[model samples]
Target: MANIEQRGENSYRFTVYLPKDAKGRYPKERMTYTVEGKYTPKQLQEHLDHEYLKFKAEVLSGNYVRPEAMTFSTFIKEWDKKYASKLAKTTHGNHVRKLDLHILPEIGHMEMSQINEFILMKLLDGLQRKDGQDGELSFHSKRDVYRTLKSIFKYAVKWKVLSQNPMDGVEKPKAKDTEEEYQDLQVYDEDEIAQLMEIIQNELPHWRAMFTLALAAGMRRGELLGLQWNDIDFDNNQITIHTTIVLTKGGPHIKRTKTRSSKRTVTLPLSMMEELRTYQKHHKNTREDSGERWIETEYDWVFCQFNGEHMYPSSPSNRWAKMLQKHNFRYIRLHDLRHTSASLLIAQGIHAKIISERLGHSDISVTMNTYGHAFKSADRAAAEKMESIFLKK
Candidate 1:
């Protein structure tokens, strides 16, 4: 299966001839593998013989694949350059961390053709969030790893490196108790939202405008922080979301919407638009007052700092939490404001599809899944209306 040849006094080369490929195509240029190393005369023959046997075993087992392509690490360079570049910066950054920190270090050296279900499962099972937690990994972290692996294996199949995706054999990861996660979903009910609407009016002009628009438009945190003045259409009372700001260790980063659907236009209530106009006047005065000191960002951010810099991504959440605490209000995470907006629409019997479009959800199923409680309430009201009509007949 192999032979050893002397290249120098202490260096020798071992070449192992690989077997025929799938279609029985028996011989190609890159199918053979050669390893050259300097070895002592006493150990040279035995070392080359062992390496030849090992190489032949890999070829027989269908693990070596096309030797030129070689390891999973080698395939990733191609995937990163060609495919991963298309992914959103936040998503691509996340994938890079999962691959480099976890997956690649473990199996990057293994031939792409050699990866199997057992190997993948073991890697996922061993995953743990290195942050403040016990050894048990969070379901979310493990799920990300599973998603990353599945995408890689799927591409491996498409790129003809592997015959099938090994992830097909692996069960999808799930939370141990999904109900516990659902129970943690805190949203302000209609009454609480109403009270906040009134309270924010008296609090401050800047915060009032921000909080009102958040509840009205149901924009994500980053989307709100990244909102630019040009994105607004005063004539139509609408705003487009095509860019987002994500805080990074280096600083804030402007990224495109994660998916096509995430780039959307949301129609605001007329009253909210009116309030925004008023805020714009106030903002202009503030900017002029800071004339010499005002900083400018790439976009004319609608929710800029007093000095006209882009608002920090986490600023709203932290400030919201403090405001709730100070006022002794029932607390919910800032994200739950989005859920509160959806709930208000559901209460008014807005169609789920319309709500999904307004919220810029990638799929209607995501809207249904996250706000099933609101859907249930809407459904109950529909049933009662049907009952009243039938009873009257």
Candidate 2:
């Protein structure tokens, strides 16, 4: 039985009575509300009645929704639908991948109400252990997973879906600063770079121009593929990065650059300028050969497939991986090309602010943070030079 008692002129208290057991233990399952003064007694009564009926229906149907049942998988789908439009495609894709690969498989079906600190700690412990695929998960990956879970729970609390986040008190695993290992970025020294360029020009003529552009221009893989003839200024020897090719639900599409700062202009080096001029001559001839078959969009991308179709993001990365494997080069990620460019610039004593602008980073902080170790090395060299000057005096 449920009853509503008027506490004041603008207040009403509602209570639901649970059946008592033989031991006279009654469950205190009740909800209270204080109606606004604007509502008449009849209107207030109607609203209260509706709420009571809804609660009764839920009780009868045995469909009580508990917070514990809100698994990561279920909540993420809801979150995506509600917030996907506001998120960048890459970010949304990453969120979905993290949930699927880390959160869902571990605790997808568990009741959200049942998840407590103890359960989460155990789960983290399991993740740290090396039993699963790819041996044990790295500290970096584990930290990311933990952070993702924490964010989800925080959102759940804000939405009133849960009273508190279970991850609130959980401590994250300590991660070593791996910056030292990459202090001196593993890039081809001048001799090695010369050898690589020679091989590409002589042996792999087809991919020679693209490899040269990547090393010289420092354009990101996706950004390189997104390059169009229209974006290049032959007279000025500069290239504007306004868009990038990314994989979306329907397939790959030319999306806006990752950030506003990423859409920038970088002056092409003399060597790269010459290569582009030659490549452009060949590209135009090829387009003319295709004639009517050419699908001309307003943006004339510089790099495309042999058939003049837009290149997929994965193709170049795959090629790079294969090249590295064949040459027995250290397995550096494709993005390392961008790092190599920044490293070379820093090594030449270029200012970080200039590098930041060239790299199209949103701020100098991004440049410093990403290549802080390189900067530290430069600082050490500066100190040594100063000591040598003073000692000579």
Candidate 3:
């Protein structure tokens, strides 16, 4: 039972009785209503009644909204206008692409409020089942689409445009477990590292310094691309990571580091410092020759394209793939370099906290979770040492 009682001057209290079990133990649920601006008590009651009815309807329908003749495409466009500026450029671009390629063509004609949880689930199921000429949806592409939908519903709730997020209760399609197959960290052994260095120096001379920096410093691809001459302190053998370069729909853009803690300084090895010094000399000469034509933004980036434009993160992957093929080595993702650095550091007995900071992880927990295998290996090594000491004695 619910009632509206007059409190003082245009103010009223709305109370609802929550039913209890045989034991008379029930949770309390109530609301207070205060009306302003010359609304009569009857008018306020009517408005509240209408809102209550709409909320009740939403609950009865499992939070389903009947499509209001607005197409998914139109809604997405509006959503972008309202929310894109709040997102990173790369993230915004990705959301746009996902809607255009996956969601819009399939269900853009449907009404905005009409998409129920079942229909949304079916759509995702269809996407998971889809196969291009090459075969089924790539793992990365599938995950991207799922994430996009999740974000869209999240935004709907945030903007109060939807009473409830329909996709919230829907289960996402199960993607292949590729993480174990594609190890997050792929550090080369001493021999492989030596071979890689030799190959980069001999064949991909332009990439030698980049590879060295990645392996030695564990910088993210964007952070590495965003580096500037000023960011490097040769005297101190340190590099200050501040920002990241990302590819957006409007082409490349610079953004703050992914997390606040990602903006940190990493001490470079002496060998890497020497390499950077040599690269700096060449980079300065290149910049001077290019003059005003160079794509030197306000932030003087360290690595630039042949024409002096900022290097794209994708460029490294392409280069790495070609180099891997040329050298008859297994191709690894560019991010694997960071993992390689972490693994190598752990193997050398560097503390986990130091590794976490060097890799720009927000917390040591992240490092531990991702690279806990390294700690287990360390434990084994410690046990072996202890056994040796005791057994020999």
Tell me the lDDT of model 3 at 85: 52
Top TM-score model: 2
Task: Give the per-residue lDDT digits (tens) of candidate 2, residues 1-393.
Answer: 437777666555556555786889975444444454466768877988887777556544665444455565667666778664358777667666667676788788876776788888777766743345555566656777787777778877755567788998789955456654354345665566776766566434336677777777777877888888888888998989888888765578788897788999999888888888887888888888887787755657788865577788788888878887777766666677678788888888999998998898999998997788888888898889999999998
lDDT scores of the candidates, listed in order = 0.79, 0.73, 0.75
What value of lDDT does candidate 1 attain over all alpha carbons?
0.79
Model 2, runs deviating above 4 Å: 1-64, 84-86, 118-133, 171-174, 179-186, 203-206, 296-298
What is the lDDT, from 0 to 100, of the residue 24 in candidate 2? 91
Q: What digit string (tens of lDDT, one per residue) describes model 1 on residues 1-393?
A: 336666555444445555587878665222222334676757866776786677667666766546335698988876888687677667777888888778898999988768889998888888765666657566667778888888887877765567788999998777678554455456787778788887787756777888888889998889888888889899999999998898754567888877888999999999999999999999888888998788795568888887788888888888888888888898888888888888889989999999998888999999998888778878999999999999998
Quick one: how many clashes does candidate 3 have? Answer: 5
Candidates sorted by TM-score, best first: 2, 3, 1
| lDDT top scorer | 1
**lDDT per residue (tens digit) for residues 1-393 in model 3:** 455567667555544444575887864433334454665768866887775555445534555333344456666766788776568787888888788778888777876677779888777766743334544555457667888888877865554445688888777665466454234456677788888788778643347788789889898788889888888888899999998988788887888897888999999889899888888888778778888777657667788876676787689778888888987987777778888888888888899999999999999999987788777888899889899999987
Candidate 1 regions with alpha-carbon error over 4 angstroms: 1-82, 100-115, 122-142, 156-164, 175-185, 198-204, 248-250, 328-331, 363-366, 369-373, 385-393
Comparison by lDDT, 1 against 3, better one: 1
